[model samples]
Target chain A: GAGVSQSPRYKVAKRGQDVALRCDPISGHVSLFWYQQALGQGPEFLTYFQNEAQLDKSGLPSDRFFAERPEGSVSTLKIQRTQKEDSAVYLCASSSRDRGTNEQFFGPGTRLTVL
Target chain B: EDKVVQSPLSLVVHEGDTVTLNCSYEVTNFRSLLWYKQEKKAPTFLFMLTSSGIEKKSGRLSSILDKKELFSILNITATQTGDSAVYLCAAFKQGGSEKLVFGKGTKLTVNP
Candidate 1:
């Protein structure tokens, strides 16, 4: 079985520029989640989706961060204006059921750097 | 406020030795505690503990939760060099926007 996967393993963007990160969850997974991990730290929850519905977006740092999962399979996280503070690894995960119950399978995170 | 804390930020041990990692959490309305091993990218799940006094084991790795004390312990017996990585502990809240509260993690380095 293929695991969750993210694109553009590494990205570097100038400040004030916009960037988009992609994530492909496992097939048949009903739950998808995004997280941000800074260096020497653990991952912090960013958002969660159940199917095609955006269930939780509380962890999003600011209005610049937005995510969507229209078809219930692939998800994209967009930043309107990149900032140096946004430089971190963005991780995606998926589970067969609600994240409250099932274990999440992680993807190789996409490292984003804002210069 | 620190909701979860893992002690011994970094550890170094030789192969065939045993090691223990600790995690204590103060997550509101806690539901479960989970352990993950991270090397380079993705963090792989190791165990999920929802009940107290029940130990979960897989190969040389084992974990136990103490709900009453609000803590958990991950143990590795006869460790190998492959076991070297960052171990993360997370607390799942029963009902809240913050689903999983994670600790800073313990970086374990094993030498053969």
Candidate 2:
């Protein structure tokens, strides 16, 4: 079976440009999560979803970061007015159940760079 | 806020040696502690400990959690070069939609 996957493995955007990253969770996965990982640092949680409902978005740094899973499968993370500080690897993970219980399978991640 | 701290930011050991990595956390609504190994890519889950004083072992790797002391330890016996990677410790909180907070991680290098 296919594992979690993210599109645009590498993205280079102008400082003021906007970018959108996509995530495709494993089939039948009920839980999805997004995280941001800086170089030489651990992943920082950004948002989580259960099916089509957004359960948590507390870790989002600012209003420029927005995420949605409209149909309960694919998810999109949008960042408006990208800044240098926003350059990092955006990771997506999925689990069969809620994250608190099941092991999360991660994707290759999208490396976003603000030039 | 929940915080997970991993000690000895980096370690270097030779093959056939043993190494121990430590993790301590302060989290609200404590739930479970998890360990992960990362190479150049995504992290892969190792063990998840929700009970104290219980050892979870897999091959040459073993981990134990100490809930009373709010700490955990991962031990690797007979270290091999393949074990070289960044070890991340994460704490999961129950409330507020089950948050998982990760540590800065400890890098381990095994020389053959």
Candidate 3:
């Protein structure tokens, strides 16, 4: 695809169940970002990957949330023991360069609903 | 802690009208500010303002940043139905690590 892509556009999981969201950033992009957006709220930063390195994860809400980008191309966010509050749209973005002025391209995002 | 706040949580206007959305931020080591437009899915990039008093423009959309006031405003002229979306403002904090803090976003509705 020409732009960023996310898998499982919509996912419904029961409480306490685990879920994994996938993101395929723009090819050869050096910076990838994960953000969580709740209803009527702006997307909140979750983590950032510079190439294959997981440099920042301070925005992650809890230990149950984990993300990885082994090849520096694809990334995955895993939520363990999900609760109702964990339900939100997970968005992925990729930027061409690692600078303050780089504009990020975003994917369609995965809307997760915890029942 | 860094924070970004957007004013006029929601606005409704007829087509061809102009609207201005406001964003204010308080962050240590501010580097840049960005604006995005989100509809049903992900947000699309709009503009990035680093230097104060300079306006960035794309078609009918334009934005300007005020460093002294610690605020920015997104202006949409001749609004169309397609322009209806949530406009987001985010600030990048520069220091040991780089992080972007986003505001709540302002929802705009354009009626035909």
Candidate 4:
């Protein structure tokens, strides 16, 4: 079975540019999550989607970050006006059940560098 | 704010040695504690503990949770070079929605 997958393993963008990262969750996963990991630090929560509905966005650091999962299986995390501080790994995870029921399977992640 | 703290940010051990990693957390609506192993990329799930006093074991890796202490410990016995990786501890919270709060992670270096 295929695990969660993220596109553009690496991306470099100029400051102020907009970038979009894509994630393809496992075939039947009903829950998806996004997280940001800074250098030498742990991954911080970004947002979560249960199916096509955005359940939580509190973890998003700023208004510049946006995510959507219209179809419920694939998701996109878009960053507007990239900053050097945005340079890090964007991880996507999916789980068969909602939180408290099962563990999440993570994707390889897309490493973004803003210069 | 929710926080998960791991001890000994970094450790180095030789093969055949046993290593224990500690994780303590303080968060609202704590549901479960999880452990992950990261190797240069994404973290893979290791263990998820929801009840206290129960030990979860998988081969040479084992974990025990103490809900009263708000902590958990992961032990790797007879460590091998293959065990070298960053070990991450996370606390799952189920409030309005589900979220996994993480610690800075512990870098483990197992040299043969």
Candidate 5:
């Protein structure tokens, strides 16, 4: 695809169940980012990846939330134990440059609903 | 904590009307300010401003940043119904971990 793409546009999980979301950034993009957006609010930063290195995970809410970009092209976000509060749209973005003036291109987010 | 704030949580305008959206930030390591238009699942990039006072424009949409005042404004002139969406303002923080601190957003409704 010409732009970023995400799998499982919508996912529903029962409490305590685990779920994983996938993201495929634009080919050759050096930087990737993950965000969580709640209803009537803006996207909140969750983590950042510069190639295969997981540089920043400060914004991650809990230890249960984990993300990895093993090969630097595709990434996955895993939630170990789903909760109602974990319900939100997870967004993925990528920029060509690894640093400075990063104008990120976003993918259609995956909306997760925890029941 | 570093954060971005946007005003007028919601707005309604008719076709051919002009609207000005406001955003203010109090953040350290401010690399740049950005604007986005989100209608459904994804947010489309609109502008990214690093230097103060320079205007970035795309068709009817234009934006300007004032670093001194820690604020930015997005102006859309002669709006159309298709322009309706949630306009987001985000500040990209620099340094070891580059991340965007976003505001709650301003929802603009353009009715024809």
Candidate 6:
């Protein structure tokens, strides 16, 4: 794909139900990132991957929010036991370079609703 | 902890009017600042400022950074209804983290 691609544009999950969101970054991009954006709020960083390495998961709000990029290209963000507070738009981005002033390209994002 | 704050959470302006959005941040490692324009879905990259006093411009949008003050501003001149959207500001942390700390964002609505 020419840009980052996200699966399941919209998702509705019952409380305590688990959900998984997938992201396919641009071809050959070395860096991938996941962010969560609440209504009317900016996208908050959740995790970062350099190639297949999960380098940072500091911005994840809780232990239930887990992300992985197994093959260094496609990534998945899994939420265990969904809560109403977890409702938000999940964004994925990728950068061609691994370091030094690289510009990130973003995906359309997945809107998750927890009820 | 670290935070980024944007002023005038929402704004309404007539077409052809100019607008300026502000962003301030308090972070641990300040490497660069970025501006993005979001419409219905994804946010499109606008500008990235790494040094103080230099401005980045594209079409009718412009932005500048002030490393000393830990702030940045985005300006849109001769705005149109098509320009209405949410503007986001993000500060990049230094070192190898490569994470972006973002502000709440400014929603601009241009009435025709």
Spell out the clash pairs found in candidate 6. Answer: none
**Which window of 10 residues has the lowest lDDT sum in candidate 3 chain A?**
A95-104
Error of 5 at A81 (Å): 1.1
Alpha carbon lDDT of residue A64, candidate 1? 100
Best by lDDT: 5
Using TM-score as the yardstick, the better of models 2 and 4 is 4
TM-score of chain B of each: 0.96, 0.97, 0.97, 0.98, 0.98, 0.97
**Model 1, span B1-112: residue lDDT tens:** 5499998899999999999999999877888899999999999999999999999999999999999899999999999999999999998876544357789999999999
Q: Encode model 5's per-residue lDDT on B1-112: one tens digit a residue.
A: 9989999999999999999999999999898999999999899999999999999999999999999999999999999999999999999888888788999999999998
Q: How would the candidate models be sorted by DockQ, starting from the highest?
A: 5, 4, 6, 3, 1, 2
For residues A12-96, could you state the per-residue lDDT of candidate 4 as single tens digits? 9999999999999999899999999998999999999999999999989999999999999899999999999999999999998
TM-score of chain B of 2: 0.97
Per-candidate DockQ vs. reference? 0.65, 0.64, 0.67, 0.77, 0.81, 0.75
lDDT of each: 0.92, 0.92, 0.93, 0.94, 0.95, 0.93
Q: Model 3 clash pairs?
A: none
Model 1, chain B only, scores a TM-score of 0.96
- Runs in model 2 deviating more than 4 A are none
**Model 4: residue B62 alpha-carbon error in angstroms:** 0.5
TM-score per model over all chains? 0.96, 0.96, 0.97, 0.98, 0.98, 0.97
Fraction of the true interface contacts (Cα pairs closer than 8 Å across chains) found in each model: 0.62, 0.60, 0.62, 0.79, 0.75, 0.69
Pitting candidate 1 against candidate 6, the one with the higher TM-score is: 6
Error of 3 at A109 (Å): 0.5
Q: Write the per-residue lDDT of candidate 6 for residues B1-112, one digit (tens) a residue.
A: 8899998899999999999999999999788889989998899999999999998999999999998999899999999999999999998888877888889999999999
Better of 4 and 6 by TM-score: 4
